[model samples]
Target: MTTIKLHNTKTRKREDFNPIDDKNVRMYVCGPTVYDRAHLGNARPVIVFDVLNRLLRHVYGEDHVTYVRNFTDVDDKINARAAESGRSIGDITAETTQWFLDDMAAVGALEPDHMPRATAYILQMVEMIEGLIAKGHAYAADEHVLFAVESYKEYGALSGRSIDDMIAGARVEVAPYKRNPMDFVLWKPSDDATPGWDSPWGRGRPGWHIECSAMADELLWKEPLRQDRLSEGAKSQPHVFDIHGGGLDLQFPHHEDEIAQSCCANGTDEMARYWLHNEMLQVEGKKMSKSLGNFFTVRDLLDQGVPGEVIRFVMLSTHYRKPMDWTEKKRDEAEKTLRKWLDLTRDLQPSDPTTFAPDQKLLDAVADDLNTHLALTYLNALTAQPQKLLDHARWLGFLGDKARQDDEKARSAYTTSMGSGASDALASLANRLDELRQTAMQSKDFSQVDAFKTALLAAGVEVRMSKTGVDLQPASNFDLAKLDALK
Candidate 1:
């Protein structure tokens, strides 16, 4: 068995992963809050944990690994969007949820075993909040149930911050009723205008932190192995999941509050054994912001005709712990590499991941703290063996028979409309692009190559370059007449 190692944010160390039950490996990554389209930043944890899920399934049989990613359907953002758009909250949530699904699928993320909607788990969340109040871990004040952060001595353990520090640095809701400055809401009352469910406290909605804790308990945790079976040592069953992951930004209040709520409510010492947090993402070397004119949703990139595979490649090119900078130059290089890999393995067919043996080094790279960047390096090394490359790419969710079929359909359409001459023209342009690059390489100047690249792009050609050479692929918007300028 390949031993897996992961960096645990809670412990702040890279440690060997030992699942409590080898037959079942469970992971929960926080999913999108479906108020709007999932932006590029939202895709980082999705891809990071998607890779982790794949690795888990590869190790523990596909059926044994259960991955849960939830949808935060009920949020202030959703309510505001509904109000601003003058649409019903339910309708907006449903539409945004589907959009999130479609956008993630384009980026090659697998649907998790359980994609629980926060609204669907409201009852469970309510029950958990009630339990917290009963246990003196929470209290109801001002029609809101707030977790007593001071009640849990280890409240800031996961984030490594003292209560005083958090109180000073935190953007705490300045509520007159909160017992302490750092106390967080477990449930809050909702007016007739806001989405609410009847509960022991009042007509209220679950706070963000309680939703995930309850959902994980329902979906991932085993039901205490039946009381009768506990005599056989089942009482020692793990309290929660093997791994919990999200962006670093969540590490402070959201995750810390979850730890306090779950541990205090359940009488357990831990919530998740390993906590993994991926770093934030940037665009064009600066924070992605609408003010910066760099804000882009995943759908926006897809609409720009950047393939999901290329986006994923650019994402995984950097380690999860390192802040990823999304740059056009990197996108171009990633597209170029994928073009070569797809072309190299075009004749081959994708198969079941189990049917083909992945390169040992590739597997090793993945196991070593999910060194995905190193794994990509290993994937790059497998180019000479098309069969090996195609199978491995399929295992990684890149190239598959469906992708080929789609390409073939496009190729067929092109051949039918443009005739056979179009094929020769593309090859000629590819050769021309390569000749320009080779001459520029010797001259220590890439002015001509950049000029040709710009023109080819204008004509809807996706230019790819590797040490082997340049590969020119016609994009969906290819214009045959525009190539005459380059000629």
Candidate 2:
């Protein structure tokens, strides 16, 4: 087994990854706010970290990995959207969250093991706030409770900036009740329009940053006192997780604040052992924004006929930690590459079971904190050699027919234009195709078997049966260049 390494935000260095519990690996990634349609920029972290989660499960047993991603359904942004749309916040959040899940699924993002919502964890947030107040790390003033920035000595450790520097850099809001310029809200009183809950302080709502910390601790942490001793003799040992990931934009205020709240409340130096942040996706080297008219939603891209896999491949083409520039040409190139891999594996016989030697260099690149750019380069080099391309693609989870169709249309336009030699080539192609179809039939892969037969027939190949199996040959002459054009 290969050792995976990750860049830990806390230490600001690439380090070998070792899970807290060898049997159970835990991870939590911050999820969407659910105020509006998720833009392509937002999808970067979702897909990038999803791949990380997939890799972790592959490395460890599937059942051993616990990946938690939460939703901020009760935020100011959501409240504002609800007010503007003339709908209740609950309805708005619910609709947006559903849409987000659908879009993420389209892009091949795996659902997290746990999808905790902020509204569902209000009690947990209130309890954590109470604990902070009891511990003297928080103070209530004018019906608002604020976390005392001076109390947490390591507040700026993750972001690598001094408290004074952060204060100066931040556009700190001047509130009369706040003790320090850097003190942030834990809970603030809400009015008739905003959602509120009865707490020790008053009728208020949980602050945005505090929601993630409490939700993570609730879902991922197990305290002995909270365990039921009657049903279970003794509390199970705590399973410390491996990773916490999000976008780079969260590094300063969001992630930094989460670290402060969780560590200070739990009385532990380590909340999550390793923190990972993916770089943002930009358009023409500028931050994508609606105001600039450059923002693109995932649905928009899909509606434009850009395949989900192509979008995913483009996202993975760059290092997860480096900014990716989205361009039409990039997507075109991704589509072309995906088509080549699909063609390479189209006639592959399952019985052959091509054994691919793991590309050590590619594995090393990915293992070293997910250097996807280098890994992609290695994959490209392997594809340049005809024999190893299909095998290499299988390891990358991009070789199967489903993965291919996810990008290219069912029948390529190029294949339709092939006039003369295409039919002749189909005869040779049919021989190899028949072998794969028979293997699929024997394995009871009815779907693949059906698809192979249909594709061959559509491409002017005729199949006939013999005692052993099926035999196929082309119907007439067709142009190969025209087929390439369709591709």
TM-score of each: 0.89, 0.79
Q: Model 1: how far is 333 from its true place, Å? A: 0.8
Q: After superposition, how far is residue 329 of candidate 1 from its true place, in Å?
A: 0.3
The residue-by-residue lDDT of candidate 2 on 345-411, one tens digit each, is 5655322334334567867777878877777778787654655676665555455455655424444
- 299-359, model 1: which lDDT tens digit per residue? 9998987889889999999999999999999998887787778778877766665656677
Find the candidate with the highest lDDT and give its number: 1
Single out the weakest 10-residue window by summed lDDT for candidate 1. 225-234
Clashes of each: 0, 12
TM-score of 1: 0.89
